[model samples]
Every structure is written in structure tokens, then in C-alpha cells.
Target: MLRHFLTLLVLPGLVVNSSSSRSSSEEEKEHDDGSREKESNGHHSNGHGVPWGYKDQTAWTFNFTDCSGKSQSPIDINTRRAIYDPTLPPISLEGYDLTDDSALTLWNNGHTLELILPNTMRIVTGFDHEFLAAQLHFHWGTPEVPGSEHTIDNVHFPAEIHVVHYNSKYANISEAASQSDGLVVLGGFIQIGLHENENYEKILAVITDVSIEESNTEIPGFNVRHLLPNKLDRFYRYNGSLTTPPCYQTVNWTIFNDTITVSRKQLKALENTLKAGQEEHLNKNFRAPQLLYGRHVLASFMASSTIKNPGLGRMGERNQSTEQSEGLSRGDILAIAFGVLFGVSLLCFLLYTYQQHRKYTSITKDPRQNVIYKPAMKAEA
Candidate 1:
């Protein structure tokens, strides 16, 4: 009985030690996280420390220093102020449809959800040079706050997706990132609504798998075109930098005017699903709009056109022969109809006047007609 009592006492001590060790380990982990966050907020002796792109950093003032470059990005796209450049060609996205499972890896990079794509994808034309596909990522905010990086006329959207590419003229994406005119990013706005955006299902369904920071999963390749707006012709273009830092000023941005829809539930999944540390979810991952300075924002569509009558500018340059067959506007057709009717009426009136003059001449001047209708005929009648 004494031995049994001693075993029980020892067992309680062992349990206490085990609990204490676990608690200490957890605290140590938390401390490590806190230290990392603190260190990242302040500048390190070396150039690299925490990712300079993180929004959570509070100490280092230098994180925003790169943001003040001459050509920073996420500017407000004032459509009215934008220049209508007919030279801005329709952007051609090559190999956007990925079917091989081995080509795709979806990851939660702690800051945002990123997808690794194969280099087979590319931008054939649009800019002065060709840009090869690198990868894609997202920026989003909570349900209440819209989080798109680039705003339209200062209006924000629920989310945004950036399809990043590198100037193929350079060796690779990393090499191109620091050079001017070395990157081209296709930005698409994401709006929340009632119906499920079928195109978003590929990304949304995988959110649960990578709910934690640094978590990743290999996904079967999907049609990447679905992620973009249906109308790629109309877009806002400008010279800018990566919204993230080392805020490279190499990016030539093209933000689509058309917005893709995401269901409210999917947006909730995005806002609440991914987490940075054990503390909380990734709420706001977007940087606010940067200043334009003296930069020009060019548009692919004509400025005179409205959203209802949006012009598909000069498709002939991209696709040969076949034009955008949407046909003329009602106003254009009406003008043509009025022009035709005026021309026909004028012609008919001229012809009737000519005929009357001809008949009068024949009656008055023709020898036989004159003999019949002259004073002799009147006297006979």
C-alpha cells in the first residue's frame, strides 16, 4: 500500500513536469514570433531580414522609403483623366490555359495566397517587349473594407489579383524585377456578389488546404484565363513598380476595366481563411494607392465611349482580318439611315424636276407636238 501511494505521488510529479515543459515550449515559440515581428518592423544591419513587403511591420521606416520612388504603383485610375492611346494594343495572354497537374502549386506565403506557375505561359504582345509568366498572387481586405490595390476613379474593390510576368528579354523574373521596364503585371479587380463566381472555385476550394502560414499544396492545373476579365481589350496602363517591396519600379501595369465577380461566401473564406501566425487571420493585405507624380495613365479604349458602348479598339492589330463584329450602335445606324433617306429624296426630286422640264420642252419645241398644241390646235378645239 505504501509503494502504491509512492507511485501515485511520482505520477502526479511527472504529469506536472510534462505540462510545464509543454507550456514553456509554447511560450518560447510565441516569443520567437514576437521577436521576428519586432525585428522585421525595424531595419536590420543587413539589407535583408523580414520580407519588406509585410504590412504588419511597424518599426522600420525604410519599408516605405522604396514606396516613394518616382514611379510607384497602385495609383487611382482616373478614367476621365486617362489618355486614349490607340497605340495600346489588345493584350495577348499566351498559354493561360494550364492542364497539367505538375505545373501548379498553391501556397499561403503568410502575406498572401500565391500560385506557382510554369514558365510556359507568356505575354505575346501588348508592350514594346515580350514578358514571360512568373507567378500570380492576390490582395484582399475584410468584408467591410474593400482591398484592391488599384482603384478606379478612387473607388475600391473587394479584392485584386495580379498576374506577374517578367521581361523575357532578361534572364529570369528575379533578374528582371529590379530593372526599369522589366515586368508587366495584369491586374484584375474582384467584386463580391450573391452568385458564386465559377471561375473562382479553383482558388477558393483550395483555401482550406493552406489555411496556415507557409502551408502549401499541389493543385491540378486549371484554366487560368478564368481568373481574368472577359474583356481584356479595355484596360488602364501606366509605368509603375511592384506594390510589394523591394518596390521594384520595373513593372508596366495593365489593370482591366472590367471586374470579375466573387461570391460573398468566397470573400468570407478569403478574409477569414488564411492566417499569418497563430494569433489571427490575414485581414488587410493591400497597400494603399501611391502617387502618380507626372506619369501618364493610358487607356486602350477611346475616352469618348461609355461603358454601355465600350469600344473594342482596333482588334485588327492582334487578330488578322476578323473584326469585332458587335456591329454599329443604334445612334450610328440611325445616322446612316437618315443620310441614305436624304440622298434618295434629293435624287428623286431632281429626277422629277428634270422629267417635268423634259416634257415641257418636248411639247413646246417638238415639231409634231408643236403642230398639235400650237395656236392652230387651240383654235380647232
Candidate 2:
């Protein structure tokens, strides 16, 4: 009897061990698949990363038809002159206010200032750009580094705020989102430092009241203009797509080279906001850097001139004098003029022949005789 009982126990143990081993293997496989998806160069079997049909838990989806050829993505900034009429209307954030219930205000409170944007703002003259603020969001790292998205060049900041916007005069956000001219996102990089933002403090004061499960807060009489950088003159512009899922390829991203200052307190507030209901302490919020997507980045000096270069890599300190001229070159202009002249000459020749035909038709009226008549008096000479 004792031997039989021992055998039974051993058998159960063996079965349990085998099952556990299989479960672990399956888990590892799933993890590997996820890693591969993330590391992929914006390509997926279901077109998850590319600008095609894909959807996620968030209400966002990717469909290229919705994007514009000149649609702004996260990195790309297209330069066309924007005509602004000061007399037409001034954008007012007067009725806007922030509270624990306001999602945007909550984000700003957490030192992710770049995320909460105004619906309308100022327009820059030569850049042909206007400010439209979208929702606020964050990206972070594991406990070791603590914050920010890791860039392709292996550079990382403390945290980044993406203030998304669209050119409303053209179309609504959804319609505009798919075009190259569709969206414009202003990116502000935050670094952990000693200086504290007073505006951020008011926001952080109410973080404890906001819920974790995507809730909205009401902030009465909020003025969004105060949150922007005072020196709007300097910024790095590029053409890139959305960094998040549905990774829509329509965005004109303007990343300010100037890093905003956030206090350690503000950073902690953001960490707390992210930690609302997680048991395992899910701290990471950033998506890994994406492929540069064969785009060029341009920089314009508010105080000086515009600098344009290939968007393959980072910017360099080439003097304004060293920059190459853009648009139609001298040779191109000459070619265009010559083409126009040729077209005009052809048009004039056709007109002269039409007039001569009309004159001949008026004089030569042959009802029965299908013969041409020459002037008889000329033969005598």
C-alpha cells in the first residue's frame, strides 16, 4: 500500500512540472513576438505600424486616405506661408479652465506641458504656421533610467510632451489627420532640473483627485497661452509621422531645441498619475524611436534666416552663408520662361491661320463649281 501511494504522488508531480514548463515556453514566445513587433521598422502583417488600416484599444486608427500629401506628422514641418489676419479674429482661451477632471490640465500639471495644447493660437509669418493644441500625453522608461522615449541615435530625455494640433481652417482633426498638411505637433522635451514651474505646481496640486481610467476634468477660465515658450522664434522643424500606434504618417513636427525645466516634484506627480491603479508599478510610457522615413529637417532662425538640409540626421552648425538656396534655381527659371515663350508663339501662329481661313471663306462662295478663283486683273501686269 505504501509503495502504491508514493508512485501516485510522483506521477502527479511529473504532470504538474511538464505543464508548467509548457506554459513558460508559451509565455516566452508571446514576449518574443511583442518585442519583434516593437522593433519592426513600422511594418506589420496587419499594417499595424505603417499608415494603413490598423486599430488599437485607444480610439485611434490608421487609414492613409484620411491623411494629406502635405499632412504634418510628428517630425515633419512643411513650410508654406500662412496668411494671418489680425483683424479677422483673435484666438481666445478665455473660457478655458483647468481642474483635476480636465485631462489636458492634468497632463500639464504633471510637467508634460507639451501635451495639453490650445485649440487655436498665434500664427508665424514666414513659417506659415499656426498653433492648435491637442491632448497631452507622456513617454517614459523603466526604473533604471526613469523617463522619456529612447531616440534612434540612442539619445534620451527625462520626458517629452506632444502637443498635437491640426489646421482647422482646412478640415477637422480627423479628416486633416491623414494628409501631409493634416496635422502639426509641437514637441517639448523636459529635463529634470532645479528650476520649478509655478504653472505646473497648480496642476500637480490636484493630481490626487483625478482617476486613472481615462477621466475628464473641468478647469474654468483656463488661458493656454501662458504655457507656451516665450521665445517662439527658435525651433527645429522636420517631416515625420505619429510616434504612437496607428502611427499615422501625416504630421509636421516642430521640436523646440530648448529643453523645458521641470522640478523633481513635477516629475513625481507625473509618475503618480501613471501609477493610478497598477499593482506591478508600470512606469514606462514611451514608444521606442521609429525609422527616420527618408525625410529632411529644416531650421529657421527667428532672429536670422532659414536653414534647410536633408533630414537624414541631426542638425549642424553651418553658418547662414554656407546654406544652399531653395526652390527654382536660375537655370530652372530660364527653362520655364523659354517654355512659356514657345507656347505663346505656337498660339499666335494658330490664331493667324484661323484669321486667314475666315477671310478666304468670306470671299470664296462656291454653290455648284468646286473650283478656286484667283484675281484676274493681276495677270495683265
In the order shown, the candidates' Cα RMSDs to the true structure are 16.9, 22.1
Question: Model 2: residues >4 Å from true position, as ranges?
Answer: 1-118, 122-131, 150-153, 220-223, 276-282, 301-381
- Give the total clashing residue pairs for model 2: 42
Candidate 2 residues 1-381, lDDT tens each? 234222211221121112111100000000022221111112221222232212231333323221222322333232321111122122222223443343343322111222333453433332344534434455554435655542312567777655555555543343344444545555667767797876656555665555343233434324444444545445655555555433445455656556666788787766655432333233455544443433444454421223333332332233343333433445567899999999999999999999999988877875645767987776665
Per-model TM against the reference: 0.66, 0.50
Stretches > 4 Å off in candidate 1: 1-47, 51-61, 305-381
Q: Which candidate leads in lDDT? A: 1
lDDT, residue 361, candidate 1: 81
**Residue 264 displacement (Å), model 1:** 0.9
